[model samples]
Target: MKGRVIVLDHIAGREAAALLVDGKLTDLLVDDDSAPRPGAIFRAVCDRPIKGMGGMMLRLPDGETAFLRQGKGLALGQSMLVQVTGYADDGKAVPVTDRVLFKSRYAIVTPGKPGINISRAIRDDDVRDRLLACAHEAGVAEGFGLIIRSSAAEAADEDIIEDIAAMDALATAIMADADGAPEALTEGDGPHVLAWRDWVEPAKVVTDAGGFEDMDVLGQMVSLGQPRVGLDGPAFMYVEPTRALVAVDVNTGGDTSPASTLKANLAACRALPRALRLRGLGGQVVIDMAPMSKAHRREIEGALRSAFKTDTVDTALVGWTPLGHYELQRKRERLPLPAEVMEALA
Candidate 1:
C-alpha cells in the first residue's frame, strides 16, 4: 500500500496540513499554535470537585480546566502531575489524567504502572509473546509499564529498550518535580503531526515552501488547500462535523444508474472515515448513505470497518440505525478538528 502523503499549506495566515491518501484529500489540519495538543504533560491543581461525576476539575497553570477522575491523591490546592489526554469541546473541560503515559515511536511508557501490554492491532500470538518477553527483559522500572505499539511490531529489542529508558527517565523527572507550581513538562507535536503519527503505520510527511518548516515536515506539497473538499465527479457529497456528531450526506446530483449510485455510495463510505480523521471528528458520527440492498449494505459495513481500523483513535462500528443511517462511535479525548479551526479563525 502506498503511504499517505501530507500536504502542508498556508490558509488565512495559519498553517494548514492536508492529507492525501491515494491522491485524494483525506484530512485537513490548521496549525493553531495556541491550541494545547494531546499528550501534553503538566503540573496541575485540584480546583473543583464534581461529586456526581466522580472527577475533579483541575486547573492548569494556564488557567484551563481538565477533569480528573481520581481525586483521592489530590488536595484542593496541592499540585500534581497530569497529562492532557483530551481537549474541552461543547462546553466540556479538557480531560486530564494522573496516569502519565510517555509516547515514543515504538512504545508507550506508563510510569507507576507495571506489566507489559501489547497493541490490539498486533494479532499474532507468537509476536505478542515475543514482545512480552522483550518487555520483561528490557529492565523496566519498578512500577512503570510498557505498551508495545503496533508501530513496534517490527522494532528491534534495542529500540524498544531505548524508548522505554528515555520515556522512563522523563517520567521520573516529572514525578520528582511534582511539588513545583503548575507547569508544562513537555509539549507534543502540532495537530497534524499528532494525528499523522498516531496512525498504526508511519506515513510520508510533506509541506509547502511557505508552510510550517519549523515543524520538521518530511516534504512539501504544491500549495495550501481549503478545508472543505468535494469528491466523486460532478456528484458531490457534503461532509460537516459538529462537536456532538459528524453528518455526511450523499448527493447523487441526478445520476440514475444503479451501478453509478452504488459506486458513488461505496466511494463515499471509503472517503468518510478518512475525512473524519482529517477533520478530527470524534464521539458519535452518522453517515447518510444512499439507500442500497442489504448485501451492498454489508459490503459498506465491511469497508467502513476496514477503513476505520486504520485510524489511530478507538472507533466502534455501531451498525446502522432504523432509518438506514450508519452509526459510528469514536473515542473523544482531544479537541475536535473543527473546534480548533474555529478557534483559529476567531
Candidate 2:
C-alpha cells in the first residue's frame, strides 16, 4: 500500500491490469474485445477518399472500415499497411495511420525513419553511450530506425540488445508481407502484457488468482464509475462525460476562507490526471474551476501543467476559454469502461 503495486487480474472474465500507488488506483487497463485495438497492424485496401476531409476510407479484410487522415497519393485499389490509432466513436470509422511502428518494452522500431535515438529522459552521458552501443550491437536492419526506451537505462546490456533485435526482426517480417491482401498482421498486446511493458517502474507484481478481490482493485474500479473525486479537505471535482466533451466541475464545498477557491482549484488540478487515466476518458475536456481572482490564473495554469507532465496520455492544455473555463484536447488512447463490465461488477 505504501509503494507501487501492479495487479494482473480479470474483470468480467476479461484480462485486466491495475496499477496502485500508495494504495490508490492510479491507472487501469481492461480488455475490450468489441473493436480493433490501438497498435494493431493490418493490411488494408484503399477505398474512396473523402474530398473535403482530405482523408480516405480503407477496407479491412474483416469487413471493417478505417479512416486515414492523411491519404494523399493513395490509389483506390492500392494495398497498404496501416495501424489502428485509437477506438472509434459510435458511428465513426476506426482512426488509423499509414505509419506503422513495432513497439516493445525496451525498443521501438520505426520503419521509414532510419536513425538510432535514445529517450530524452536518459540524460546521463555514460548511459546514452552505453545504450547506443547496445543498439549498434543489435544490428538493426538497414532503412529501419530504433529507439532505446527510457526503461533500457537500468536493463542489462544483453536484454536491451535482445529486445532491439526482436523488434527489428518483427518489423522486417511484417513489412515483407505488405505485398499480400488485406488482413490483420498482428493484434495488440493484452492487459497483462501491456502492464509489463508500460508499467516499468519497480513494483510488487501480483499475478495470483483473486488478486483483484484481495487487493480491492474491483472496489476501486467501481469507484471510477462515479463522477465525484475527492480532493483536499472539503474540496472535490465531478468528472462527467458527455457526447461533446468531458466536463469537470471543481468546488470548494463548505470552505469559505479567502483562499478557498484557489486552493480547491489547485487541488482539483493535481487530482485530475489520475482521475481521467483511471476512467479511460479522453477527447475534449473543459474544466469549470471555482471562481477565483484573475491574478491566480497563472498559478492555476502552472499547477495544471505540472499535474499532466508525468501522465502517459497525449494531452494538450488549450489555455483558458473566453468564458474563463480551461480546455484540454487529449488523444483517445484508451477505451471507456464498457457497460457490461460495470454490470458484472455491480
TM-scores of the models, in the given order?
0.76, 0.98
lDDT, candidate 2, 192-237, per-residue tens: 9899889999999999999999999998888878899998999999
The candidate scoring highest on TM-score is 2
Query: Lowest-scoring 10 consecutive residues by lDDT in candidate 2?
Result: 175-184
Q: Once superposed on the true structure, which residue ranges of model 2 sit more than 4 Å away at CA?
A: none
> Which residue runs does candidate 1 get wrong by more than 4 Å?
1-30, 70-75, 120-137, 191-234, 259-261, 292-297, 332-346
Where is model 1 poorest over a 10-residue stretch in terms of lDDT? 216-225
**Colliding residue pairs in candidate 1:** 27-278, 86-333, 87-334, 206-219, 207-219, 207-220
Give the per-residue lDDT of model 1 (tens digit) for 234-293: 455777766567787876667777776677777777677666665566788888887677
Every model: Cα RMSD to truth: 4.9, 1.0
Write down the TM-score for model 1. Answer: 0.76
